[model samples]
Target: MALIFLYIHVLCLWLCSSTYNAQNVFFQPSFLVTRGPSVTALLYGNSSNIILILQTTSPSNVTGSFDPPSCVPEETRWVLTSELIAKTTVQVKLRLNRSLRLCGNNETDTDCCVNPLCVRETLQVSACEGNNSQASLIVQVKVYARLVSGNMVFDNKTIIQNQVYRPLGECPCDLTFKTCDLWCCCDEDCSTEDFQLFKYHCLPGPFGGQFPDPEYQCSVQSSQNSPDWFPFLCVISPPGNNPYLGLFYQGNKIAPKPGMSFGASVSSPPTLLDAYIEGSPILTLKDQYFTIPRTLNGYCVTSAPVAFLKNFDVKCVTPLQACPTEPPLQTIPEDLRAVVKNGVGGNAVVDVTDQLATELNDFITSSESFGSSAVVCENVPLALDYNFYWKENGISGITLTRTLGTVTLNGNVSLTTRYSAKFLSGDITSKPNSGNPGYQVGRPVIGGILNTSIGNDSLLIERSPMHLWKPVNCGLCSHADVRPVLFGENSTSGCLLPVSQLNLTQCGLLRDTVNSLQDGLVEASLVAINGHPNAVTMADWLNISYVTLNSSGVGDSNSSCSNIPAHLQIYVWTLVTGFVDEIPQKDIKAVEISYSLSSWKLECGGGDPVCIDPAETQRLPVTSSVTFIDIPLNTGPPKNRYQINFTEYDCNRNDICWPELAFPFTRFYTGEPYSQALAKGIILVFFFIVASVLGTPWRQIRQIWSTI
Candidate 1:
């Protein structure tokens, strides 16, 4: 029993030893594949004394192909078949052996595997084929793997350590494929030598079949730093508003509306209008108005009521030819003589001669007979005078003494005739020599004649019953009322109306006649002339026809006062004689004479009542004066008085005839004393006293001489 028991024990020990070896060989973790030193092991073992063998799965023997092959000897051996390990799971550890052989049949040769480089790898291995090690557990080893470090083979495919590899085929991680520095892609084919790596965001799968999401695909070349690809539109939204759409060419934003037309030479890129179709039915190039689409936004056509771009033009013209001209003056006709009969009133016959006559004839023939005619009288050298005359007839058998003046006519048959010149004396019978007498005398005066009968015939004279031409202090008969009468010869018979009716013509005939009647007087008194020294009464000098009228007395006798009528007549006669003797010198046809009369009141009384008794009555004495003078008919009166008379003398005997008369008296004072006797004595005594005084001086000298 003892021997048998000992045999069982020996047998049990051998069986248990074999069981331990088998478990350690098949299931022991041996090689480590780690990224760092012992931090994470790809394979871990519980035994410390296990041997590690590393190999590379890569076929290349380059330095970076895989890990270097290494052997780690231990007290115990950890065994693994090559079939159970992947070549990609092996790692190799290698060492530099300058004197050793790395691939040869000699194991102890000096230059074999001495470089201390090892590889470990985890790889995928193929099954062992026909003549390979099949008995005795012949394992096939693969040094290259997909992932490896040194010469170790890992059962798992995880890389336990960081390792370098020689990239094979077309490795994307190769340095030859690296894009760095300033290198750029120029082609769209990313697989070609000139292809560039592109970065693209995953977008909706539409254009180029790209994916959308977090994954990015490499397709076309990136537009960044590219010359051909440009940012066609860039719109930057405002803070709160829509983004601005920016269109760019060659990286610059193109203007939306360009001023200049396209296709024209420009220095910059085209505008936005050239690059885009903006809003709704965008304007296209096919429209009828789109002849020049390049100028689209440049000039847009608005709606109706279209405004033109600018302005238009204008023009003008003119004409050609010319015009015409005109003419001159003339002369006036000369004058000729023209005589018109009864052309004007009075002796106012106008003689039109020369130019005046021609004008007058033209005027007369063109005008009516009664209407006015321009009878032009030129250079009429003859002096024209209008003369007036009247006749006087009052006393019976009285003859008038008249002086006839000589007359001559230069043209036509003119004659001189003497009308009867009469004295317009007041009375000389009452006081034969009175100094002044109030009397107005006229000849052949019709309206103012005195009615009387001589023998069996009746006579009418231009005398009043009082023998005064007008009353004393008669306002109407004053100088204002006197006017001259004028006469003219009959054309055929050369006969004139009587001087009383000489004023019967159109030129104031009625006016002159009325004036003469109201203001004229006729004188018919006989003047008595005496040849005696003593004073004579009117009764003493009787029935005288003529007297020697003298202005002063002769031989120491004082001159006696003459009657006014007789003295005026004598003065007129003297003038007539002188005029007749000087007839050749006289040029006028007649002469005009004017006369006047005035009177004043007188009272004769003293203040003694008894010496000149109240019962004794005294008579008042009144005196008057008349004067006659000759003046040119045209000369008007210088001063006017109470009464006046006018008379005209006709030098032509061809009209109106009257007999010559001597001086005649017209008025006399009826009751008045003849104080000439007392007056003469007083005048003689006054002259004697004056003579004695003058002679006294001379006589005294003579007396003294005699006494001596």
Candidate 2:
């Protein structure tokens, strides 16, 4: 017999979870200039009123003939802050949907517009502060566009990489015109000779533009072989060296000028589209657009926007510097606006309930606050729920609410915000069904225990118990949050339970509690048919795992309780059917449950009679998971079926013969029938016999036969 020993160790460390660029921001302008003046502007404040200051040096000659600068709105004034020898400073306050007025008395409109203010404006020092001392000092203000001529620009903002767009080249590596550049094979001026000499050593363009060669491989090993290999020559190899580089050329072959805006012209709020795109922002009823806050790759984004007819629930952790006084809809300007004015009458106003404000205030102030020394005061959002009623035309009404946790001073708050959006029909205002005839993908799965002990024919279904698993004191598991198992989603949740003094009495109580939590699912008698609980039949259940507990005796000094239930895993198998123009229907087919058990034992040390730290309590982790597996619906049977017998070849005379039936030779059989194969074999044999007999001499053939 052989003996084996195993050792296991566990370590847990609580660290302050922090991430970079958690908020979703559009157009992170990071300007880089090689040989030109550059200006940097920082915006500070909320969305209603944002202040931006620009300071740059002005050239003395201001009378250069150039395109006219864009006009600035009346509400936004560019005030001259300071005027020095050749430098000037100006400030402007920007607001959303502000009106604009005509500036000059000329009948021809130069800068004024019937629409909103232009994003690009050129303010003169004289016009801003009536200081005409420097005529050439015109301040060019460009928003969401490049402000300087540069070869490269790097922005660390969260950009949706899934968008389909043509890249406008800002850097041209081919500096020389009509001339061959050394090691620049992409240069159009380079001839075949120049290309051949520099092809192996071609350098990548600054903005990742390369020659359009679809078959080119940038790998070192691939370059070291034939076709790409240059014998006995060192070649430079860079990753992703392919023809389809990041370069996107314009049809006109003209490079965009500096300070050119690539984004769409924003004159007013965008109109509603037939269907909203995923990750694209929701339409703004007024000046504010609704953003679904979420975290991507561990960083929080304020605008993982909602897609029309697509339901979602996103939960993420974001760090807040201070506790918020107002609701998230008001504090975070990205939320959908609640109040709007009636366009008919200027004074007529449409009122909305302050549900978010009231809910958030109660959530924050109602929670228990801790002292500075006892509790760490880092703030994170608790939850933000959005319910929108939309019709065929557009969104009809919206209801928003927010919940915040404890707030502390000078403490970093780690909060988790769960944001969910469900769009209901404007006419149908009742609780939305999981599905019309089948279960929806994101909706909660319906499951419960059916009780028939009440009467002979009476049956009652009890809702499944849910364990609270909220984050407490920055811990991974807690006992405050409530969540459900959503359909088509596989998720695991657990809570920590502290057990003190694992004795027979305590173990018995734990056993009873776990059994109650199991809810007799292990011995379920029936199953729902097509996700319809009322329509059920005798279930053909398969037991994945059975819960069991074994103990030697009550208060047995040498024995301990083993096989206590510690985990429960639920497996739901659903049959998914496709529809031509409707949402996919998911119907429940089967369900399986598995239970895992744990044991309680103490370790003795130093030859002590009792266990070490026997009085200390242990935090045992209890977890449960629900996994959904989609089974493709069987679409009838095949048009033709193969034979059951392996030995018999039963293919039709017109059809191709079975390849495996060529038994003696286990090779692929040609499409030809056996008769044609035999005829070809006989003809080849006859020709070979004739050739051998005519080509070979009799004496040589006899000698070959004798040797064989």
Best model per TM-score: 2
- TM-score on alpha carbons, each prediction: 0.12, 0.37
lDDT comparing candidate 2 with the true structure: 0.46
C-alpha positional error of residue 107 in candidate 2 after TM-score superposition, expressed in Å: 22
> Model 2: clashing residue pairs?
22-300, 24-302, 62-136, 213-243, 378-412, 378-413, 379-413, 380-415
- The sequence of per-residue lDDT tens digits that candidate 1 reaches over residues 1-708 is 999999999999999778655543222222333421111112211222333342234435566443223342222111233221342232222222132112333355443342222223242111112322111111122121111122334343222221122211121121222221112222122233212212233122322223122111122224574344234333233321211112111122233554676676758853333221112121222321211111123332211110111111111111101110110001111211111111111121112222211111111112123433323322321111111111121111112222112112222222111121122222212211211111112321111223444443544232221122222222222222222111111111011112211121222332333324422332323221211111223332222122332322122211111111111111121011122233311111222223221111112346633223323322211111222233344333453342223222221332442222211211122233335544555788799988987797868988998999
| Backbone-clash count (model 1) | 112
Tell me the whole-model lDDT of each prediction, alpha carbons only.
0.25, 0.46
- Best candidate (score: lDDT): 2
RMSD of 2: 24.3
Off by over 4 Å in 2: 1-382, 389-391, 394-401, 411-444, 448-496, 502-504, 516-528, 531-559, 569-587, 592-599, 604-614, 625-708
Candidate 2 lDDT for residue 636: 59
Q: Which residues of candidate 1, in runs, are more than 4 Å off?
A: 1-21, 25-46, 57-708
